[model samples]
Target: MSLRVEGLCVARGEAVVVRGVSFSVPLGEVTVLLGPNGAGKTSLLEALSGILPIQAGRLELCGREMSRASRVVRARAGLSHVQQGRVVFPTLSVEENLRVGARDGLEEAFRLFPELEKRRHTPAGQLSGGEQQMVVLARAILSRPQVLLVDEMSLGLAPLVVKRLLPVLKGLAEGGVGVLLVEQFARLALSLGHQALVMNQGRLVYSGPASALLRQPELLQWAYLGRSA
Candidate 1:
């Protein structure tokens, strides 16, 4: 199954943020969305998660149309979003946070990130940045989503911590979950992605194999800078 978007448009109030975007995130593959600031990557991810309404166009998951589904409906339909920043309840214990995601799957989540089991009773705010990110990830994993949208997951984190976290996403993709990732670190995202798409000012400028983009930095530079390669 795959998550498909066609002519997708999103707006914030009166201003359009994403314009006529079309792409597909297939099962067992990582599709990386790359662009510089104000490139509309986050807006597109938010639309896919159903947090932002689609001003136009269509969305389909597993071949079923979900263009107008609510955020909660999308979540129940196997969609999980790990937004920018390590979002967790600071006052709640780690277990409590996971419980919020789902009452079960604690063991599986802990198995994926064993460090969490040791800190299960600790308040999430007390954990290190990386550890807190793990909690967010573990919570998403516990939900057992078929399609995962991760927006700027590595922001404000150390390189080592990012290294540990990204592989978990890759592993999830390998195990038949479609992962749509928007990462600030383009090189690292390209390395893990199977397909890549670049955006510029709310439109897709490039779409191709991740390896192809790696071999051609100028294309990426052009898309981000509006310069001739």
Candidate 2:
């Protein structure tokens, strides 16, 4: 199974943000979406998650066409999205918030995030930013999604925390989940990714193996910094 996008276009009323974007994220692999700010990475993710209408093209999750599906339907069909920022329910306890969409995997969530297990009864709003991010991750993991979309997950977190979180995403990919990660830390994302996709000016500038990009930093420099590769 895989998440397939073809000739995708996204708009925010009157203005187009993503234009004719296309890619494939097969199961058991990580596809890193890298770009500078305002490069339309987030807009692409939003369109895939059904949060924004697809202005054109097609989206298929696990072989099911889902261009017109609602966000909740897509989620139920094994597409999970963890958007930027702490989206946990502030008034709810950590465990309560986790239980909202979880059909199972409660223990697995706790196992991946022991910190949350220890503070399961605590209000989600009281946790630190990193801890809250973990809560969101744990909840998403518990859903056992076929396609997981994570946007800016490591943003505003400590380096160590970012390090810890990335491995978990890798583990998920290893377990047969298609993970599409949008991140600003280009090197770190490439390190964990099986495939690297770079966007610039709302278009895909590069799409290839992660190792190739890592071995030749010039390619990244050309895509991101406009230097010769």
What is the model-wide C-alpha lDDT for candidate 1? Answer: 0.91
Listed in order, each prediction's TM-score against the native is 0.97, 0.96
lDDT of 2 by residue, 130-182 (tens): 99999999988888799899999988998788888999999999999999999
**On a 0 to 100 scale, what is the lDDT of residue 184 in model 2?**
75
What would the per-residue lDDT of candidate 1 be over residues 13-53, giving only the tens digit for each residue? Answer: 99999999999999899999998899899999999998899
Each model's backbone clash number: 0, 0
Name the 10 consecutive residues with the lowest summed lDDT in model 1. Answer: 220-229
Q: Can you give the lDDT of residue 192 in candidate 2?
A: 91
**Global lDDT of each candidate:** 0.91, 0.90
